[model samples]
Target: MESPKIDIITLVENLAYQQGTKGEHGLSFVVRTSGRQILFDTGQSDLLVQNAKKMNVDLSAIDAVVISHGHYDHTGGLPAFFEINDHAPVWLKSKAFDEKMSKSTGTPRFIGLDPEVAERYRTRFRTVEQVTELAPGLKIVPEIGSYYGFEQPSQSMLIKHGKTLSADLFEDELFMVFEHSEKLVVFAGCAHRGIGNICRSAMSLTGCNQIQLVLGGTHLKGASKGRIAKTVDAFRDLQVEHFGLCHCTGLPAFMEFSRVFEEKVRYAHVASRFEPFD
Candidate 1:
């Protein structure tokens, strides 16, 4: 049988302007194709399940869950999620369980996912070392090493290993690649590893230069003007078709990208749907 065309829908995000469903500082998306329906990033709380209920979405039907990283804002909903769907593999990086914390105020704050919850469903977790194809025309892109100069690893986010704290290189950050309309569409968790890095890694892995859409968070909220401008210029140079940006893409950066991309950019808020042929 021929592969199915992919359709992605933003189920829950940090903002919900018109969806009636509540939003929080997190992200979650539902990617549907003919063979498998995947849930990407479960948001910061059980709110994902609540919002899915409001949208008439059946969480039990999800074939698997693709977590972006170990951050709670993206993985915190797993406990509640697993409750709804008795069983489904959670795909993430191999070392995704590493302890992660942030010290923005010079005081450590836990930013990683709940360990107790993850331990409870450890059997369902799938550790990915590199790019792995989940199904025909669908793949999980993992650990795209840094390639851009401006998008350096954050010092605030730290990981503790054997009494040592080092910058969280975001080795756990990952993205999904799906073939649709003969174009490659990227479903990013948070792009915690830089959007350019992810796009470039995807191209290198798939050997495809044309990216149809880059959907989800870019984590560019706190980036400098020069960096944002350079990023926009880079995408333009890449000839990217559409950008469904949301979450950590700060207001200023988003506006800059909006001006550059025009109607090709849309806020990937809760309930936003990305179906090319629709």
Candidate 2:
């Protein structure tokens, strides 16, 4: 059977504009294809609900929710989300339960999804710790058994019972790769799993090195210029033709990628949509 063309709708993002300047926190995207609806991740706050309301996206009809990782900014809206649609299965990594931290100042923070919320969804949702295929053309990246020398590991922590500890490179961090027509589209979260490494493993899983489009956060905030440049060069090998970078991608890094990729890189603004043709 031939794959169906994929359509992505950006319902929530950190940079949402209500009228002029004020905005909310977090990011959320919806992917629809083959008569199924999949939500990539929920933003850090309830703006997802408000955005969906304003944008007219019905949460009740969504089939599944794929959490990139367990950061509050990405999974914060789950409690509110569950209140609206309690039946959709939630997919995430098993190790998403870790401490989060600040890389530059080494400050501790609350970054994991609410345990109460996660536990509540445990009955209806599904969690995977390894590379498991969820549906046709969709798979979750297994745990990071080893961290290759692509880039320095992320500096974050998960707060539990008022105790601060080094955050584990949660193996639960995963990305999705699906075939749209003849090309592959990668849906990533914060990319806590090194972006380059994620691409490498995703390629290994799909047996296709050519990525036509990439969406979601690259987590390149505060990245060094050399590292960003090297990443762009590596992308040349992957032949990524389009980019929809948003959320934690940071302004400076997004501009850098745009400078290099030109028309190929398009900023994924809040309330945006992309239609990939077959």
Candidate 3:
């Protein structure tokens, strides 16, 4: 039997591929498979809606919305999304609403979604606590554990507990897996939990070793040389066939990946379209 053709259109990203489409420091994708349209992440603003309009994508037709994590850059367009689509349920992990902070600049800055939006559109959210099948052949894998100590969570990210702050383990982070026979197509957002860990989790959950393609942010910006080397080695060991990385993956890591992966790597910019099963 032939596998279903999955069409992924980049609705928002850090780089614009087309002239009319604008770019921002965020990520979003329109994934079409099994006769359904799934909106994966909504970038950081109304740029999602604007880019969708420019690219001829109808937000009103989305069957579901999957938020990869609670970061504002990934969930900031929820208000705009809900303003347009009234039926599609927004799926996310329970901890996605926790107060997330970033201290990369030595000054704590809030990076979670807007509380007002979360309150106003509370009814639209469907928080999942475990592995869930969103649609036929489409699974949402959450609570990714770090098997590799080198793939640790960023120490600069914190979760605010009232006044005290602690390292954000990113329990709210999740990744999407599209099963196609013995192969899998993984979609990650920022990959705050680590891309290698995300891939391993997907393979373990689905029991599939062949990752046909991996697309999304890796959060490897400013990562240590040792970390990048380990990640590259991990990907090679995982046998990932293709990579469409972007956003926070960082130029250094991208260059290293391209140099190592060669023709197997491609930058997934705004307006980029990927048909993994084609």
> Which digits, one per residue and each the tens of the lDDT, describe model 1 over residues 1-278?
65568778788898896556888889999988776889999998999888898888899999989988889899989988998998789999866798888997798777897889878788989888777777677889876856787776567889878678888988888888877555678888778778888888777777788888888888888878888888787787775788899988889878998898888889998988898534
TM-score of 3: 0.98
Ranking by lDDT: 3, 1, 2
**Clash number for each model:** 1, 13, 0
Candidate 2: tens digits of C-alpha lDDT, residues 1-278: 77677788887776765453224456788888778888888888777787788777888888998888878878888877888997898887666655554544565545677777777667856777667665667666764423346655565433344563554555668888776555678887877667767777767777786787788887788777876777777776777878999877888878888998899988787877888554
Better of 1 and 2 by TM-score: 1
Model 1 root mean square deviation, Cα atoms: 1.5
* Cα error, candidate 1, residue 161 (Å): 2.2
- Model 3 whole-model lDDT (C-alpha atoms): 0.92
Per-residue CA lDDT of candidate 3, range 52-151, in tens?
A: 9999999999999999999999999888988899999999998999999999898999999888899999999999888888777888887786767788
Error of 2 at 135 (Å): 3.8
The lDDT of model 2 is 0.74
User: What is the TM-score of each predicted model, taking all chains together?
Assistant: 0.95, 0.89, 0.98
**Where does model 1 exceed 4 Å of error?**
1-3
- Candidate number that wins on TM-score, 1 or 3: 3
Worst 10-residue lDDT window for candidate 2 reads 16-25
